[model samples]
Structures are given as structure tokens and as C-alpha cells.
Target chain A: MSEKPYVSVENISKWYPYKGDKLINHEKKFIKANDDINLSIQKGEILGVIGESGCGKSTLGKLLTRLETPTAGDCLINGVSTKELIKNDMKAFRRSVQIIFQNPFDTFTPRDTIEQILLRPLKNHNIGNSKEERRKLCIERLEEGGLVPGEDIMKRYPHELSGGQLQRISIIRAMLLDPEFIVADEPVSMLDVSVRAEIINMLLDLAKLHNTAVMFISHDIALTRYISDNIAVMYLGKVVEYGKADEVVNNPGHPYTKALISNCASIDPDDEREEISITGEPPTPLDPGPGCYFAPRCFMACEKCLKEYPDKKNLSDTHWITCMNAE
Target chain B: MKNNRLTIAAQAVKSNRQLMAGCIGVLALLVLMIAAPLISTEDPTIYGPDVLNGLGENGHILGTNHLGQDVYSMIIYGVRTSVKVAVISAMISGILGVLIGGAAGFLGGKVDVIISEIINVFMMLPTFFLILLIVALFGNSLTNVMIVIGITTWPGNAKLMRAQALSLRERVFVKSAEAMGETKRQILFKYIIPNGIFPVIANTTLGMANAILTEAGLSFLGLGDPSIISWGQMIYAGKQYITSAWWICAFSGIAIIIAVLIFYMLGDGLNKVMDPRYNKRRA
Candidate 1:
């Protein structure tokens, strides 16, 4: 809605040090979780981040939610730098940027009831009036997340619910806080395939209704395309390609992106046979060099792609692609 | 999230007749302790005509001790003493256990090794012998008994908690909470304590039973606190007139058995209540 972005991630990176010693010395190696990544999301926009496991997609979600501080660069919220924020500001940031984790079951503490679980965040923010008001608010939020007859669900424990129901409850918990930005890190990956679309559609509807920006992270490109307006393709902790969701999925620019689309079952099954498969598994984040992170696995990688990291090239007024040749 | 585990435990108490019976038995004893003077017809310390009337031409229903004090009244008084010793001692052990165990488990390396060594030393000491030595040295006071039991019982619970903490420290939620910028105090109190409360509860109930039984054995051996009329003391007093009045000791022994059974059952109920895996299956 505004010219300026709601949240901007500027050259942020996270490197996890792996201590080699089993003893107390703390000698270690390092694994780069995210590497010099710059991205931005405008107010009320949906940005989907697609990547395989261990590519730091979840790490990105964690950083945005302030669950983990980025080792480098700054994550700015509405032009206010996160680094300068005091304890109260950090709490405000957390309230603004919430995350729904992949495993719906493990996200909640086992000791609490559904009502108690919902009440915790409300209590943390000091929201609502009395116990009765909080209970009424929780039921309303659950209904907003598509769980009608929320009162019945509220009285039952998490284990008593099915996987799909649990996920809806998880979404209700996130929605109750009315966060401005949500990082849904594969929120439906743990659910039965039949219910995944329903959950995704509910999320999209909720986002639209509340004008909340969402960074929908998933390994399933098809699902990402179904929900996202813009898509960022990540490989081995690097965003190899990113643009308008349709363009990136249909007229893909990067070799890694092409390979991924071709491999999808939604794409022509015959495309899988003719498509160039990148050689070897993706390189580990540890010992990653200066060149393109995907060059090792890129079928079209040249000496130039190997020698230098790619920059984000403007594909259209609204689309940006990250690849050397895309320029 | 009303823990499914708690619901399952409630169901177990409702459905299992034996468990319900044991629980009720314990509840009744607790009520009796609180209403001791009201419930008992006689002053438990009063001396009367060699009061060993078994089948009754007397006011005493469960007969009387060598001192002619009602065995029933003495058993009622003992409930307060035995329950007090067990609960206080178990609490001391539980608190100390979680602290030492949690610290050692959470902060591994040398701390774990040192705690393990301390636990091993305590564990190696013969249980009955250690209790006897401490009780003998301290001179048979109720406070002395509680102190000995409390200090000695913790090593086992500490070792248990250490192992539990070590495992819990690695759970995804713990790591996630740490990554969420939660303080160490928050993690330990909010996460570790709630996750680890089951063992402490179970151990405490079991400890109460252990304490009651031990006190009974000590009193039966004439090593009881001379000023207090306990179940074990009643049994000891009855032993002197065993041939003429088997009723006194039998009644006291029955009291001891019921008390121990109740506590053990409470522990079992709690174990069922606190375990989630079982709840999942049942639910």
C-alpha cells in the first residue's frame, strides 16, 4: 500500500559455528546458515521462500521472527533497525513478526490446555479484560482461522485433535496476536496432503482480511506458487533466483529453478525426462566460497558463474531475478 | 493444552477399581489425621488397667497397647507423624534433587562427573545401615529422622534428575526456546521444571511410603521417639504382650500396611497422570 517496504532484510547472514571438540576447549568449524542475503517485502505483500531442507529457509524465518539474531547486516522493520531496538522494542518486534512452525504438534507445550495455550500470548501482551473476555476472544480467533464451533475445540486437548485440526489451532494461536508479518515456515508440510491446500487457502484468506504480510517458506514449489505473489528460490543457503511467482515458475530464469520446476509433478511429467539434472547433491554451507552457491549443481554453470556471485537483476518493474546470466 | 496425560490419569482413577480403592484409602487416612482427636475415643497416651482386651469388654474397638492406650488412637496419631516425616523429607529431597540434578545435567562436562561421583558414593552406602547410623547418632527425634531421610534420599533423585535433564536439554523445544532469546532462568523454570515435574512427584509419593515403613520398622525395634505414640511404637508396645494380646500389634501392622499402600497407589496414579505417551494411546 505504501511506496516504502514494511520490512527490509539488508545483506543479512547467519553463520553457525560447529565446535569440533567434544571437550571444553570450544574449537570449532562454521556452517553458513544464510549468506549476505538482501530481500524486502512491501506492506500487505506475500513473499514465498522456496528451498530444500538445510538451505537456511527456516533460519531466515527464525531471523525475521527475532528467534535468532542474524550474525551480519540488519533487519529493519518499517525503517527502524532491529539492532537499535531495546528490550521492549524487541518484544514489540516479536509481537509484529510471528512464526508458525512446521511441526504443529511440537509447537505447543504439552502441559497446557488449548485455552491455556491461547491465553499465554494474550497474557504476555496483557491483552483483553477478564478471564471471560479472554476466553471469548480465543474462541473468536479460532473461528476466524476456519475452525467453526471453536468452543468445542477449546475444551479439548491437542492430542484429542487430528493433524488438520491441530494445524488450524496453531494458525488460530498466531492469528490471535494479530501480527503484521507472519513467517509460516512450511506450516502445512506436516499435515496430510489432502488438507494442505485447504490450510494454504485459509492462510491466504486470513492474510488478505488482516492486511498482514506473509513470508511463506516451503520446499514444495507448487504449493509456494499457489499461495505466493513473489517467489524466491534458494539453494544451499543462497537465493539462486527470485521474481514474480508465475514468471519464476513458468518462464524460469535460473538453471536451478528450471530443474526444480521440471522435477515437479504438476509440471508435464515428460519434462522430467528431457530436463537437465544438476550433478551432485547441493554443496554443504560449510566451506562455501565466493562464487555462486548453486554453480556446483548448475548444469549450465560456466567459468564466469563459478568465479563470481550473482546479483539480483531487474526482470520487470515488479520482478527481480538473482543470477549472473539473467542480467 | 490440558495435558492429555492428566485426562488419561483421571480416567485411570475412574476406571481402575484397585487404583480408586487405594486412592480412597489414602484420602480416608488423611482425613483421619486432620480429625485425630475427634476421631479417636481415647487419649492415646493414657495408661490404664493392662489394656490388652482383644474381643472387647472395653471402650477400645481395636484393643489397646501395653500402656493400656488405645491402639486405634495411637495409630491415628501415627498417621500425622508418618505423613509429616515422609512429606517433609520427600520435599527436601525433591527440591535438592532438581537443583543438583538440573544443574549437573544442564551444565555438563566436569559438573556432571562430580555429581555422578557424589551420587555413586551415596548409592553405594547400604540403605538400612546408613539410616540406622544417622538415626542412632541423632537420637530418635522426629526432626532427626526427617533430616536423615531427607539428606540421604536426595542422591537417588538427583541422579535421576541429572539423567532426565541431560535428555531434556537436547529436545527441540528447549533449543527453540533458547534460540527465541529466552533467559536461562526462563528456560529452566518454565521449560525444564514443568517437563521434569513428573519424576519428582512420583518419587515423592514413593518416598512417603518408604518413610512410613521405615518409621514403623524402627518403632517395632524399640528405637522410636519415646515422647510420641506412633504406629511403630504401638506395635512395639503390643509385642511385649504378644501371647495375650495379638490384637494391638496386628491392628498397628494393618495401619502401617494401609498407609504404605495408599502412598504407593498415589504414586502410581501420578505416574499415569504425568506421562504423555500413555495419554496419546488412551486418548
Candidate 2:
């Protein structure tokens, strides 16, 4: 990882209110999808955010891409705050940061063929001066994204292609604009496992080739570690641990992080030792109490851990943990 | 690739036998209707006892009306009036309904509420009675009939289109477009209207047949334009001589049935072609 960071997320939080019978009573409850998330991505580095379902990993990805703005605090792209950047340079910011969605089927409009999809971003950003040049550039980019020739795919509708091909096309579209930062939220999650590695490899190569900063969000810790230079582990809307992927995998500090790493069956099945198992689902984020969000799922939950939110503790020169026992 | 799409449409056309037969029958009738002015030797209104002459006349193939005018010519002239009013009015209703419904459905919220309220108010009135009152007050001209049908027919199409648009508005692609910074007009025209308004258009074409038939019924009840020699006018003319001459009314009824069947068939074929579910299931 480089010394200088390309993107800095400083104490960001996001909440979505529940709409139900509670509304009739004039009561509002919010889902704390992201809580005080602070992280940074170095220039030309891939930072992977790994977590369980409903753990706010996807929400944080959306916040980074400006699909959904943070409720509090701010993310700084380079040196300018995201809120200020949006006012003066919204188009540039959107062009600079692109996102790859999980479901490739919904990524493009059904009426559009592959060519139209590729041409849309190019035309929107005024990347190509003419149609012929745009067409050539699209084919070239598709080839770089591992789609051969590309015109055959261009003439076809999305329904005619397999999940893998569609996903590759989506990736090609994002890369076509040559964005500086990318937030790929489970880009390969919907595809078959047999083709997952190919996509991950392609993403890694593209990141290197384009020098794009990426925040890869996924539930699979092993996959994230495979492509990511840095890793951030989230639990119940809080980053429990983050650092170099290899370091976090080898010496996980937080109890929540330890369970997540161990839970991955791919990492040392024969090294079965006495393990920590926290039962039950995570607590509802609506009106979450002042304590470690992971406290409910931690075996080492103390009284103080239950009553007070733990301050982010530095674990190493590059790692930080929001756990009470990070020391 | 283009050939494949052609073959698909061809297959659809082949499979729908009823639609094909109806279309052929309507085509034959349309040609006959258009050719009536040239084919008929007698004027529709010129009176002569010799014209009522029966089925095997020297010139009148379909026989003649009570006024001794050729039923064939009267039916032909009626075709022009009935078709002109119905087609014009159906087109008017279709364009207006699609616009009103599509905008309301796509815009949603307060716009939806207001448009829906207007549609609801129109729908609550007895449609036939409204048509009758309008025709009664406006003096039953072909133009007045067209106006009445156009104004009354729109509410149903608008309501249907609004419902369709409302559902399409919730699709993920629409949300994705919003995230991508697509304008509202682009979304409406490109996505919402294209996907939502096809059924309304198909339904309107089918509804035209019904509109024409309804106008014929009103004319039979002495409510249609007295000057235009419509199919319903021939029926009303033959009503007094019901026992003596049944061909005038019977054959005119056939013309109306054939026209209606043709539209229904076209609507059915278009629906089968346009409906996404049918394509998905069959493919």
C-alpha cells in the first residue's frame, strides 16, 4: 500500500427509517446501516470491506460511491469534502467514482443492447469525439476486460447472455469511463462459484492497469483477502478491525474479527481448536445503545462494554479496532 | 438475427388462427366497403318499391331496404360514416388516455391523485347515459358522436395505463436510471411509457369496435345522425317491416359483427405479441 491515501472516510454514518405501523403512532425508528465508519484507501490500493449479511458492508460501499450520501461526517476525495465536491463538480465526482452492482441483470436497461450500454457512459462523459472512435474504444475496452471481439456481445440483449458474460460487460462499462475510484459491492456474488475467481482476477488486473482505488465489499473473507491489499471487517454497522489483509488474517485482534476469519472454512480446516461462538443475530440498529455494536455477539462482553461505546483503538501502525480489548 | 425476429413474428401469426381468419374477413369487408360506391347501381336514399326487391335481384346482391333503396349501398355508405367517426374518436381517446395516464402514473404522488380523481369522477357516471345526454343535447351529428365517444372513452384507458405505469415506476432499472442522473422526461418516454402503454394502445384498438357498435345501437334507437345512412339507420328503417324484410337488418348486423370481430382479433394478436409474459413463457 502507498503512504498517501486517495480517499478518506471520516466518521461517516447512515440511517434509514422504518415505515410501518409505528408511523401511525408518530414514532420513527431508524436502521443504523453504517455507524461512524472511518477508513482510508491509499492511491492505487484495493481495500476490501468484509462482513456478514445486514452488517452495513453494502451501505458503506454506496456511501463511498455517493449513491447514498452519509447522514453525518464526510468522505474526502483527495482533499475536498464530498458534500462540497458534489456542488461544484458533481458530474466529475460521479465520473471519477463508479460502482458495480451485485445484480448485473438490473445494471442495464432491458431495452439496451451491449453497444448502447457501453456507448452511454462514453457519450455522457464526452470520452469519444465520434461514433467510429467510440465503437473502436468500446471493443478495445471489452477485449481488455476479457471479452473477445465484443461486437457479437454488443448486438445481443442482456437476456441472451449468461450471468458471467453480463457481469463482464458491466465491469467493462465501469472501466470504460476510467474512473479513479470504484466500489464493487459483491460484483460476483450473484454469479456461479465456478466463474467467481475469473471475475476477481479480472478486477485485480484492472485495478493495477488503471491504478484505480477500489473498495471491494463482500461476505466472503477469503475472496476479499485474495484481491485486496487492505481489509476492513464490519459487524453490526461498525468496523471491528482493519489493516493489511495478510496481517488481519494472520493475527486478528477483535473477537468479532476472529470469529469471521475462523468461520471461513477455506482457511485451515484441520486447525480445529477451542473456538469462540457468539449466538443469535445482531441487535436491531434502531436506537442502538451506547456500547460496542459487536458486544451482543462477543463472548468477552463486560458491563462497561455493554453501557459505553468503545473508542477506536489503534492496534498497529496501520490497523485500528473499535473493540474494548484491542490492547 | 433479424431473420430470427421475423420467424418469431411469423410463428406468432401462424399460431393465432382465429386472429388470422378474423383479419382476412375484415380485410375482405374493408375492400368491399371501399368499393361500395363504385359497385352499387342505386343511391342509398333514392326511393323505389323495386329496390326492396329480395335476395336474388338483378343488381342488388344483399337486397334492398324498406325505402326501396339498395341495402348494399346503404351499408356501404354507413361504413364510411361509422368507420370515420369510430376511427377518429378511437385515435383521439387513445392518444389522450395514454398521455394523461402515462404522465399521472409516472409522475405519481399528488399528480397521480389528482388525475385519478378526475378519472374516477368520469368513471362514476353511467357512460351510455352520458353519451345519450350529450348526443341528445348536441343534435346527433357524426362529429358530435365522435366527440362524445372520445371524451367518454378516455377514462378507462387512462385508468388502465396509470395502473401499468405505477407498477413500472417501481422497477429497479428506473431507480438505477435515477441514480445515473437520467432526466424525468427521458425516463418517462424511454422506459415508463414504452413498457406501460402498449396494453393501453392494444386495448384502445379493440375498444374502437365496441365504440362503433354502441353508436350503431344509439342510431337504431333514433339517436344517430339522421342524414348519414349508417347500418343502424337501415335496421331502424326495416324495423316496421320486420316480418316482411329481415335481410336489411340481418345483413347490416353482419357488417357490424364482422367489423367488431376484426378489431378484437387485431387486439388479441397485438396483445400476444407485445405481452412480455407470453414471450417469456413461449420462448
- What are the lDDT scores of the predictions, listed in order? 0.79, 0.81
Where does the lowest 10-residue lDDT sum fall in candidate 1 chain B? B174-183
Report per-candidate TM-score of chain A alone: 0.91, 0.95
Provide per-model DockQ scores: 0.21, 0.30
Q: Can you tell me which runs of candidate 1 are displaced by over 4 Å?
A: A1-4, A19-27, A267-273, A288-296, A301-327, B1-7, B10-28, B31-42, B49-73, B95-196, B213-226, B231-258, B265-283
Candidate 2 clashing pairs, residues 3+ apart or interchain: none
Q: Among these predicted structures, which one has the highest TM-score?
A: 2
lDDT of 1 by residue, A1-327 (tens): 247888899988998887666497655667999887888898789999998789999999888776677889888888988777525564566567777778877766566568876776677666798888999999987887777788987877666778788888777777777888888889999899899888888888888888999999999988889788889988777777778899898888887888888777754444534556667777788858678888777777788988878777877765666678764
Per-residue error at B6 for model 2, in Å?
Answer: 2.7
